[model samples]
Target: MPDNERRTDQRLERAILELLDRRAASATICPSDAARAAYEGDDDGWRALMEPARRAARRLAAAGEVEITQAGRPIESAEARGPIRIRRTR
Candidate 1:
């Protein structure tokens, strides 16, 4: 990947982690509401924020930092849906 793309990816990862931390502290996040408030506060686009959030979630799952499961089966689709929760593995 290009240097700029790598930097953007890192930034997204960091942003996602920060958001997750905030959610953990608050116990929940209404995605639509939070995204709107963030955009109003910083002029960031919701799609920009969401793309990275999804990427970061996938990376976390691959690293075992978070587990992605759907119903009783492991998720096979990148677009799979269900409840996604984070847990500390260490």
Candidate 2:
């Protein structure tokens, strides 16, 4: 990966935690929130970062810093598909 791609992954990881910090303890955030926070475009360009954002969340989940949920129930990141929400681990 290029330096820029590496940087984006790092940024996405931090952004994920930072974004979660701003939400209520019981609230959750979508991966797009981190993608948009790390994105520099005004258009839908952040859409391209979708998978990267998900990967970031998965990494965070593996570290036990965050919980990946589907339909309000915690699930393994590898099994997560479709829409998902992220909340800091308690």
Candidate 3:
């Protein structure tokens, strides 16, 4: 991957963790939240980071730092499709 992409990925991951930290231990945040936090635009620039945000969540999940949830239940990253949320791993 290119340096810029790597940097963006890092930022997304950091943003995800930070956003999760601000919420209750049982609370969760959507990937779009992290994308929006990483984005510096008032426009639709955050849309471009949505996929990267999901991937960042998956990476965090693999590290046992976060959980990927759908319908308020934890789900396997591979099975996590459609809407999902991120919460700190219990």
Candidate 4:
């Protein structure tokens, strides 16, 4: 990947981490509103921002920085529904 792409991926990962941190601290998030607010942009713009974040989050979950549970998948702060809440692992 190019430098810019790497940076963008890093940014997405950071954003996802921040959202997970918020959930860890807050317990729950209103997924629909949170997603809209976090990815405030038109369809294409939102997709551009969120697709990267989603990919990054998956990687992080695999790496164990974030925990993923089937019962309650970490909420993708970019989607209104369907996300299980994600939490930071000890």
lDDT of each: 0.50, 0.94, 0.95, 0.55
Provide the lDDT at 25 for model 4: 53
Tens digits of per-residue lDDT for model 4, 1-90? 999878777766666666666654535322232344455466645555554555665677678786544355554344524454445654
Could you tell me how far off, in angstroms, the CA of residue 52 lies in candidate 4 after the best superposition?
Answer: 1.5
Q: Cα lDDT for residue 52, model 1?
A: 45
lDDT of 1 by residue, 1-90 (tens): 899666655665555455556655424332333234334245656655554455555776677655444443446337566554333232
Stretches off by above 4 angstroms in model 4 are 25-44, 69-85
* TM-score computed on alpha carbons, candidate 1: 0.50
| Top candidate by lDDT | 3
Off by over 4 Å in 3: none
In model 1, pairs of residues that clash are none
Best by TM-score: 3
Error of 4 at 79 (Å): 18
lDDT of 3 at 32: 96
Error of 3 at 87 (Å): 0.4
Q: What would the C-alpha RMSD of candidate 4 be, to one decimal place? A: 5.7
> What's the TM-score of each model vs. the native?
0.50, 0.94, 0.97, 0.56
TM-score of 3: 0.97
